[model samples]
Target: MSSKDYYPMETKGSPKSYSPHKNGNLMDKSSSEQTEKFLPVIEPGLDSLNKNPEDVDFIPVDHTPPDRYRLVFFIMVVHGIGILMPWNMLINAKQYFEEYKLGKNETEVVELKGKFMFYLGIFSQVPNFVMSGINTFCQCGGQASPRRIIISISIMIVVFITTVILAMVDSSDWSVEFFWITMMTAVILNMATGVYQNSTFGLAAILPMKYTNAIVLGTNFSGVFIAVINIICIISAPDPRTQAIYYFVCAIAVLLIAFDAYFLLPLTKFYQHHRAMVRRQQNTSGPSRSFQETCALFGQVLKKIWVQALCVWFIFFVTLTIFPGIWSNVTKKDFPIENKYWTAIFCFLSFNVFAFLGNIVSEWKKIPGPRFVWIPVLLRGLFIPFFLFCRFEVENKVRTFPILIDNDYVYIVGGVLLAFTSGYYSSLTMMYGPKLVEPEVAGIAGMIMAFCLVMGITTGVNFSLAVASMAIQ
Candidate 1:
């Protein structure tokens, strides 16, 4: 038979002859079987870009990057510095307030501090809630364009700087109303920071998962630096007024961070570009889901995973907020070391150092062992109860060993455990939560966790006050 008249096999059988022009095109007898072989395998939707094997346009994803992981490190550092100043300032604020008032004794001092912090927690959340709402909208709407993101971040930084300056300027003539206003401003600024943080995390979620570790490590180190700088401020300040001055100096550090962000944002476009590219590749080759669909997927993920993250956040803030207040008051009241401020400062710095080390170990080990993180956290939880027990030993005013040494040891031990657990928990939570969530929703997941943290702080302070009041009665 002529080649033009030869028909393709529909089954693996003898060839038949058919006229291409008159009897329609020649059918492949074997081709139907071949087609049947692949009939059960469905091609993913166009949005997913899972091309058929016959398609020639399909290209394997390019995972190789031109730049090294240096950008990851740089971004992480920027993130860390941004958070460090705020956290340290908040932690040290109690000491400054106490010095200003000339308060004596743990009971009197801690009560006042606890009340102030409780109010601060409630007041400060206003900005955070606003920021979170805005962030939730932006992430869901798929409006996270670079221009929009950068502008949002810049506004947040400006708010932070402006609020800090206002607080500093008004410090000399501070009143309760002014204090409330300052706290409100600080909270909004912090909320703005949270917005930027969520945006960044959303951007990260779409990229390869390895960069998450870098972010986690960077945040931990930022906490460390904040602690170290706070210690220096405590050591150098001779009086409450001077301590306020040091805080202003730390504000300068924040100003520097703002400047860094300004300059670095443009230069870091490559990193951003790389992330976008990878995300697109994943979206194209992996699965098909619309923006709305992705958001819905993320919501489900949040509902499932947030419970554990919330628990972690609650435990963290309880120990973090309450104990620091108690430790500062107790140290200042009973242990009048020649430089108690320095002792406090060093203890905080040492705590950060231990936290930094913990992060390094976590990064180096790269193990998914839950115990690696949980054991340290559990130990810290245990340490909290221990500290509560020892509160009486210090309260009795007994000279067991030297007063300063005893106080120092207690603070150091507690601080170290707290720092270690905080670093470990943050790392593990970020790492594990994503595994169980849709990548698109990781930003909101983080936001929810942040919300839990603030809530925890609020509850912990309230609990502390209630306990203190009960003890007095």
Candidate 2:
């Protein structure tokens, strides 16, 4: 009954324990089961012997199912487009909102034109930031799910439909009221967008890194898609109401496609397999954590990815601060193009096209990894001044600062650089985010990165107000 009685210490390394049939003794040959029973239990990592599978410090063989025909990738991209369609549509329809909708009367036009872009930025991104943070917490608690994505998309659809209806009614008589109504819609649409965006990021995080980048690609592409449409509208010269209708219709169509694509995800073996893996890990890790526990997990994940997360935030912060708020209003200076197309081409079209290209480039290769990614991202702050001094046509506000970069080509180049870096680094940071943490909490990391993204935009937009004021005063 002694510890060494069954197997003496000398037998620990004995060949008999491994193969009693050694030396070809047929009578002494041990059966496979007998040999297996005597074989020593190899403890790879004694500390992990009692720990959960997820707690083990090792990468499991990736048994993830192949994304058939890249269906899952396309779905994430569609969700990306869907989540941003409302905002992009509204932003691209700058003329409609500023000129026709809010510019009905000269007084209202004067009062609103200078302030509308800032208002739009504030209304849209503030709610987006708040909701994304709240949604991230919900994700930690397991309350955020695909169902929330469905509900969020549905709410956005309804909001777009309402916008379309309002577009037809001609609220020119009530421009001020219409302005407030439009801002209200922006708030509502983006609230849903926050949840939708955060959930989509979390969902995509469950898959490969490229899948999450697909969402970033789709977001940038959404802008490109709308910008192309806007260009066409400008050339074709559609009436404001008709053009507004066209923009919302395209947005709704994209949303519908994304909504349809979402259902297909669960049916796919690839998606189901990933979902199962996550669920299994969660179960094996013991029941879901309490609120405090979830918060602790969130902090842990944030600590792991805070650098990349902040990179994601600052990237957007720099982008939003100068983009439509400052860039959209920029003109060709003393070398005016004799048409109103300069801002559209040099600003909207250029930024979107190059940004989309940047996303594609990021997908092709990640430069500098996560640690040094913040370097290029931080250097992007120079773009704020580059755009600030560009020719802006803010009504009634005189430029207090001299135009440092007077040439249109330099300005265009800056726009392209700023936009491309935004897309490229945004993609890099986001893709780096979930990967920086443990696999079980990758989804939470994705949500946190998403919140950081919104936080950046919110901060950038608010900061833009001061920047704009300083530029004009």
Candidate 3:
């Protein structure tokens, strides 16, 4: 049959047409003509095109959908909870150290135990750094499959379970070697889990940059929430049993994470499938870019913006490195209150509160400048000195209550400033890193930032130990 006879286009004032040889009847041309009428077309004027590209008519492309926002937020919350678990452990370092010292006879042994804990932090960071690097390589162009998501979630679950089991096993009165081994095992599990955790962070960074402010705010808030919950449990519970409760909560968190992973898997698979289809079409019709080429292009773009990226890495490294030592010293010596648990809670609360507030102020319209971003870092530098110099003396052991409660106003002011600085830096890191890197390589950039942070932590631990030892002598 003729092409025109098989598929006819109706026009105004056209008479009835027929393909009797095939259809056996003439078609109603008037009805078809009315049904296929074209509407008025609006064309952009030359002035409009010259004024702005936005004024020209074009199809809207939403790279990030609403569901992706929910996914990002949920992932942030889950990962925030996981990340904050270490904060509680760090806050309780003094108690853990004291317990370690109680069993050891020689000063050398005690020091060795302390060194082991420090090394544990360093070793744990190895997996973290590796994971960060891997995440940077894998995460790109919003491509993650549902099966991959499931596998990631399963790994996290297994890690959390392993951590809980180790914690439980270590709680019993056990040999020092066994205790250390179990603790190391837990650290290993945590470090391995670091791969998935850091991957999530990389993903979060690459997702819509506009949502970054919200993600930071959410992560900070969630971290605080986890810390507070940990504080309450540790304080109220009579003994080591509370650790079990912590594990149970963590298990629930893992389950929630698994559910989230399962839900996101389909969406990620859909995105990957769509990307493959587009890539295939391009390959057939035009020159197609390989993933390596895309990565190289991203590297070139980052090379041009290296200054901001390096600044972000350096600032975060400094902040993370210095803050841990400050926490260790402050929690060990300066806290006025007698209850160590209470002190830990107070420190965590203060730090998180300041961080959350810093994020809020950064978003404030009245601020109008990047000064708010620097406030936290500058405040942190100032606080370190105050923490070093300020001191409070305790006397009057005879009476039930002390005659006077000596307070270090300088230290308190410094602590507040430090907290504010931490908050500010946390917000800025999330904000500035994405700004420095292209969206496609945001994951890699975030991983690099995490590597810098881990290095800082490693150096900070050594510095703290050296300074503390020297002071003791």
Please give, for residues 1-473, the per-residue lDDT of candidate 2 as tens digits: 43334322242323221111235321121223311111112112212243443333222223545788998888888888887798889888888888788775577666787789899999999999999988888653452477778888899989999999999886777788888999999999999999999988988887889999999999988988988898788778668777889899999899989988877776676766665455444443434455665565577678879999889889999999997898887877565565567777777888888999999998878998888998989999988887877777686778986877788888878888998999999999999999876555678888888999999999999999888988885
Best by TM-score: 2
Error of 3 at 451 (Å): 4.3
For model 2, name the residue pairs that clash: none
TM-score of each: 0.67, 0.85, 0.66
Which candidate tops lDDT? 2
Tens-digit per-residue lDDT, 11-91, candidate 3: 454323221122332111123332211111123221122232223222212232244446545555555554445433433
Residues 1-473 of candidate 1: C-alpha lDDT, one tens digit per residue: 42222222243532232212223322111222121111111122222343433341222223333446566556655654554455456655655654453244455444444456445544554455456456655543242333334554455556556645554553434444445665666676567555655555554544444455556566556656666656665667556556655665665565466446534643443454443333332332223445655555445656667654655565555555444444443443355555555435544555566766766666656454533444444445555444444432323234223333345566656667676666656666555554554443454455555445445555555565454344322
In order of TM-score, best first, we have: 2, 1, 3
Model 3 TM-score is 0.66
How many Å off is the CA of 145 in candidate 3? 7.8
Q: Give the TM-score of candidate 2.
A: 0.85
Each model's lDDT: 0.49, 0.78, 0.46
Superposition error at 325 for model 2 (Å): 0.6
**lDDT at 444, model 1:** 48
Q: Report how far residue 176 has shifted in candidate 1, in Å.
A: 2.7
Q: Tell me how far the alpha carbon of residue 213 in candidate 2 is from the true structure, in angstroms, after superposition.
A: 0.2
